[model samples]
Target: MTDSTHGPRTLTVTEDFAGQRTDRVLAACFGDLSRSRIKNLIDEGRLRRNGEQLGNAAEPVRSGSILVLDIPAPAAAFPVGENITFPILFEDDDLIVLDKPAGLVVHPAPGNETGTLVNALIAHCGDSLVGIGGERRPGIVHRLDKDTSGLMVVAKTEMTHRALSEDFAARRIDRAYLALCWGVPSPTKGEYEGNIGRDKRDRKRMALVERGGKEALTRYTVLKAFRVYAALVECRLATGRTHQIRVHFSANTHPLIGDPLYLRRIPAIAKSCPTDARDVALDFPRQALHAARLGFIHPRTGEKLLFETSPPEDFLTLEKALGSD
Candidate 1:
């Protein structure tokens, strides 16, 4: 019922939980804490009933019994701030919008532990970044692939984190990406709908599967055709799935330029391109995809927010080279 050095939390049993097990009752009351966590606390003698240490988690509890729980502060397992910096589109007390460049990992993972957007955010947001999401991810609301350049949003507060996550799940967020593909699509503008899942043969890759896969949809419009060999296209996501754009385009035989995994061989059209443009296309690194636009409703103010950004210098150079031919 009161705060103390032991991180005490008190609960009073009501008539609704008159004959329930103690652990189940506590789990129902504490929405934020998991049942396993409550059991751990009970096993550690950190839970007390009527000022006495409770012994069994399955024991019955009566109405009007006062229970005290000692919950420890979470360990400092979140990523620390580093001095790295990225382009910021907008920032407020609740959230931050960033124009992330290619090669910048969004968070620390097994093969990547440094020079991530999370490291930079820690340095920028300081202690304010603590515990917005999980300790490992901190304020991260969504993710961008390491090789994909894009506009991304991060939450700085728990309230914003929850709201933004809900918005993404409800498909209320709008995201548009620009890509240069191997060939111009026939219809110029259309939607690709399929179920996407991991490839059975290659666990690391995604595939368009007939069953046991999530529904994925990508709507694309051709912006320009480049001499029948390549085309610039803008894709809008109806459902955000892993590698949705790349996998869908590849499946349709129009893989994006510079895609190492999906684009296995050079298109025949490349042989007809001007020497300079052909060289640029051949030597290009990473996928030729950029998230050009992002739109969502503000969690706190109820205002609609939209953001746009151009691709980085390398992408522009490649585009210019291709356009010259």
Candidate 2:
């Protein structure tokens, strides 16, 4: 049976299969669905032959049976922050800061226009959000990528938002990140200065450029290097540029493993690594990057504030897994 939402389709049961059990018939027609699931559907009266509910999974069905099926619509995803607990790291009359979790998108745009941090903020801040930086993004000072978890500041009023934006534009704020890379850098600790811009070949990606790009500065300190394939490193940004850490590291031949766009091909490192370390590198799911520390003067209060949030679970898990090796 087919309905409008399910689109136009016909479910045909062979006449030769008539007298077969309803579960058997459905299992045959639907490929690999479990018999128990078919039985449950039969029990729910969703499966009817000749417009009559088939109450029993064992009930015999005949050939040419007209089966009517109703496929229920899937429930919409309700975000957890709505009417649920949301951790607030810092809050005041002008702005609030949050330790945003990994996998949470910062704002709505195109395909991700809902179920974002902005959506939750809308619910939490209510009507207090004033447009920031001349956009609908209320009081948003800066952004971290969806997969990169860390501290973020949100403005509650236009005044504070403008102040923060001005500060960021002036390069007056300190932003530091923690990254788990595929291999240790040659220098262990050094500064990488380069220009970053959109890749000419792949518009969706960023690339380090010799010219015609924004100047980017990233300083690195080796936090912990394992005999394994990876190293825990801290990255401090002297200038804010898009994809600064990922791009500079990739250009320097030490891309973060599991980074979807700028993947590290470090088979040798993994192979050369000790047995325990190799196993950890193999299991991580995404590029291990985090905003571990951030310090800035309050746009409203003029007070110096320093905030730090530990890496999310995935980062810690990958760290431990690699450390175990």
Candidate 3:
């Protein structure tokens, strides 16, 4: 997808808006733009009046003056490519499907600026991969959390990026996850629906709030159950929100094992497992969740594409310890 940020915008100051603050006038005219943003643009010399750049945001507008603001293209300062290795499932000129290992971040941030999947994709797919993703995320169409290992698809071209994103947004993409939760949810197979939003008290965490939250649905079937201690479950999402699966399971009192953010304490059900299994579950390093399957329509080929990957070795070990045969 391409950036839809507006082009050079021209506004005229009429008699009614004369003597009004430049920032206020622009902000009021462009209801979507904030006064502070207008001020920043003015300070950056993007706002011009009478063919001269304007520096002050508080300056009064003159009647019948033409104000032109040139919005520059977003900077494409992608992180330098790095020689990082991940398991590639499929690749074409349009996209790449891979099994992202646990601990690898999807994109760069303040502290994690260098080593990311984006950097790796840049190195592998070359500079062309930098132009497709709608936002700063170069090739990233969707994301798997840093600790969630599994199948992911990254677009190589803008057409593919927009198409894949549309498919995902329309819920046409087939996706499923495998998770190891602390307790087996009742009724072997069912769907959990809730409105997930930020926890009112804990800003860092997401919760199933009664008001002011996006609706989220997770359908799950217990794949394997270790008595009442824990279970391996297959989850399909109807709506994707930040930490939807983790939040839903946690809200249902069946938080995933090793989920540091959501699993705040050792669950009493752990005592029900054998001592070794209990210890293994407690010692698990990251969230026991994996994006096991991803399927979508290929934009270029007009073909149905699906990719699936087994959980990483560590996840397999954890499940084995939980008594998976």
Candidate 4:
């Protein structure tokens, strides 16, 4: 059953879902809504089973039980539009590409509640922002880490959003990053493959593991070597796992220079560089990684699109200080 108003949806539990948790059943039924949302509905008494308000998301469901969910419209959440603006690399009817700078959070969160790329996009896109995915993150197709600078694409329409998301999930998008690591990776170039998941000891960080993790692959090539202290490398992602590039490189002991999370301590190579370059290597503010290139097909027009951007001034300054040796 379905109701247009209030988005009331009814689902009848079948043998397939019998004995499953109510939240799990609802998650399967409403693929677009997150499981947390379903739990919130349960807590708010908006979810009912057999005409009785069900407050526990983990309650077991019986076969043939009827479940009703009254989903409220999403609120206009955080990251309200601000006067802040970013550089637009490309724009069209379907999407907008931006050259995001380091230190800018991609979306607002608990600590970062304003002045995000979403806020800028909201101001820039205005009413053209498509809210099909969620009100808080309109048109956001993918994200770059707050400290990783460079090219990013955001959808302006639902059609483009779905198509672009599918492309990313299917690994059809071409993403390349430029990184300066503590030392030159061996053999100049190779593929780094591993399974990645949360670090059991440190939940906030991702780690490479031998099991129970998602497969991640990254191909890298050294572009320039700076003495024995650092090197400029190009990385292409085959699987975009959380902190995939950073985790993989760190696991290989060539962590990105200035990476606070992955690189635990200053590498011995840092002391070997020239005085100025050594100072730059030790004092760089953020990770020396940039999403330098991005390519994907236009969701609507089917035209292949590619965009490239150089790293920010700070990154370039550090690189120049390092020089080629």
Predicted structure with the largest TM-score when compared to the true one: 4
Q: Candidate 4: TM-score?
A: 0.78
Residue-level lDDT of model 3, residues 85-195, one tens digit each, is 989989988899999999999987546778899989989988888767633589888899899999999999998888888888899989999999998899999999998
Candidate 4 local lDDT, residue 158: 87
> Which residue pairs collide in model 1, if any?
81-123
Candidate 2 lDDT over 195-299, as tens digits, reads 776665664577876544567889999899876467899999888876789888888878886787787365566776767656666666667899888778987
Question: Per TM-score, what order, best first?
Answer: 4, 3, 1, 2
Q: Model 3 off-target regions past 4 Å?
A: 1-76
TM-score of each: 0.76, 0.71, 0.77, 0.78
Estimate the lDDT of model 3.
0.85
lDDT of 4 by residue, 1-43 (tens): 4544357899988899899888998888887778977885665
Model 1 alpha-carbon drift over 4 Å, by segment: 1-76
**Which pairs of residues clash in candidate 3, taking residues 3 or more apart in a chain or in different chains?**
none
Candidate 4 wrongly placed segments (more than 4 Å): 1-78
What's every prediction's RMSD, in angstroms? 11.5, 17.8, 10.0, 7.7
Candidate 4 achieves a global lDDT of 0.84
Q: Lowest-scoring 10 consecutive residues by lDDT in candidate 2?
A: 75-84
Give the distance in Å from residue 146's predicted Cα in candidate 3 to where it truly belongs: 0.2
> What is the lDDT of every predicted structure here?
0.85, 0.73, 0.85, 0.84
